[model samples]
Target: MLKDFKPTLFILARFILIYLILLAIYQYFLNYYSGTGLDPYSKMITEQVRYIQNYLGYQTQLYNDIKNEQVYFYVRNDYPTRMVEGCNAISVMILFIAFVFAFYKGLKIFTFIIISLILLYILNLLRITGLNIIMTDYKEYGKIAHDFIFPSIIYGGVVILWLIWIKHFVLKDKVSNELKDKI
Candidate 1:
């Protein structure tokens, strides 16, 4: 039993090692950017959200409040949402890219990574805009929407993409298909 599982375990180990290294490198860059005064990732997310709001004909404004030292923006009046590091979706992009790197390191991996990152960023901006709209109109559902519903959509999308990669790249490969036959 253990002999048969060795390859799977080894693959798992490699996944962990590579994923952590990639995630660390990503975090380092994110931190480096944030350390320079304004966090570009979060700032972009805020701006993108603002753009979406404005596109929809909402009155939007971006500003910094010095007393409390928070950088945020307003939408649909003075309704504000602060742009923080977590809202940037860097963490999700890191995880998405890590899974791709771990599963298959083919020539097309770079293309897949770029496409996945773009899709995730777009999804996140749409999520934020939808949440802002929700919070603006139906305050009672805001907490549930932000805390549970929206995260499920983003993370669930990642899970689906991972499964697609596995189906198309991993299981379709000759060696992995042989392993699947044995298992």
Candidate 2:
């Protein structure tokens, strides 16, 4: 029988890769004026959504009225934003590591990985856009969605990508056959 694929390398490489990528992006953002240029031009989208919500006078006083519940690493509005930020960090690293693993393991590097990365980033922007809309439309549920639910959706996507890479490219029957022989 084939051994289960361990996420240790995937996880570790993801951490290092994402840290470096974030450092580069942070430096770029610092050197470049306006946070507007950073993401999929979503600043405008978020702004428009927020403006529309405000203009509609749909005052759902849910978020404003609730007293924040205390939890580790959670302080009021900080948790949702933090979760989104963490997802960004994790997603970048996961993509980078997956690409490297695929390439090193003799898979089509640029064709599969580059396209997947682009799609991942696009989907990420969509997630952010949806989160922005939700945060505005349902102020009361913002914390629940952003802090827990939204991050899960994004992480779920990353897991699915990893599974695809493993099933089709990385840990294929050939790999399992070799491992069985060696064992």
Candidate 3:
């Protein structure tokens, strides 16, 4: 039964298990620190971003005067990368999940988690930067890019990366062996 089971599927299951465990840990910390379900890491990034905006001259002086609370301009959807409330956290979670899945399936340790994570992070940063450029250049199309195009880019890259890893690395030898054995 084990022999017949596709190695890629087995590895994917392993990845899911690892991902779930990490997600649980992150959730615990987030809740403990924030008094809410929001991810603490994301919150920190947002706060830092808000600070930067003030330095960039986007602070609202009226709000600062009236409420003594600095109000800064925030382009909520400008860069999908900064949408830590969902996109960033979810992508981070998925990276770990993909790593575990690939690792359990017999992928090389370096290729399994670290390389995959590095690839994802680079792409994620590009996505964020691209979104920012789009927002700056063409405000009208920013929403579509943020809501649809960028996500498709990230997810599509993930799918292709996993498929390639399984095809060329993990299952490559086993599939070849089966064919040779059959012959």
Candidate 4:
């Protein structure tokens, strides 16, 4: 009975362990910079967003409200977009990483994980940039765009990446093994 469930149990345990460990490290990182304005990663992300806005010809200013631990981006002196720790997408990245590590295959997996993380980061940046634009020009639709559309884009990207990994790496290996056994 136990033997029958061994693989399933192992995968579940691995996923939980990796997710918790990564989450703990992330929490410690946030706590370490609790008193400061914004954590370094979040600040970096905000800075990149500022640059993107500027390049897109929007007059942009970044105000770091250290007291509240929030960064606000002002565009063309209009409504500002508030950026917090969650805006940086570290949590999403952590989830993506945990799923990848849970289904660890081989050394090649590291490359895939790195590439996926980079793509996820870029996707987040674009998401934030688009959100800023929406908030600035179409204030009425900001709520729906932020609350529903943007999150779906990021999470959808993660799901697609997970599917690619399982299909290309995990399932491929299983199929190959079955083929070998048949022959």
Number of the predicted model whose TM-score against the real structure is largest:
4
Q: If ranked by TM-score, best first, what sequence of candidates would result?
A: 4, 1, 3, 2
Clashing pairs in 3: 15-100, 15-101
**Tens digit per residue, CA lDDT, model 2, 117-167:** 766665665565466556645668878877788767666766777677767
**lDDT (Cα, tens digit) per residue for candidate 1, span 36-141:** 5446666677777888888887767887543443456676566646666677677887777766777765788888778878888899898888888788778899
Off by over 4 Å in 3: 1-16, 35-82, 89-103, 179-183
Global lDDT scores for all candidate models: 0.76, 0.51, 0.58, 0.92
Q: For residues 9-112, what per-residue lDDT tens digits would candidate 4 score against the true structure? A: 89889999999999999999999999898899999988998899899987788998999998999898875588999889899999989888888998998999
- Superposed by TM-score, candidate 2 places the C-alpha of residue 48 at a distance from the truth, in angstroms, of 10
* Alpha-carbon lDDT of model 2: 0.51
As a TM-score, model 1 comes out at: 0.84
Q: On a 0 to 1 TM-score scale, where does candidate 3 land against the true structure?
A: 0.62
Per-prediction TM-score to the true structure, in the order listed: 0.84, 0.51, 0.62, 0.97
Residue 62 of candidate 3: its Cα lDDT?
Answer: 13
lDDT of 1 at 91: 81
Q: Model 4's lDDT to the true fold?
A: 0.92
Error of 2 at 35 (Å): 8.7
How do the residues 58-123 of candidate 3 rate in per-residue lDDT, one tens digit apiece? 331211111221222234433322344464535454664657464545546455657767677667
* Per-residue lDDT of 154 in model 1: 90
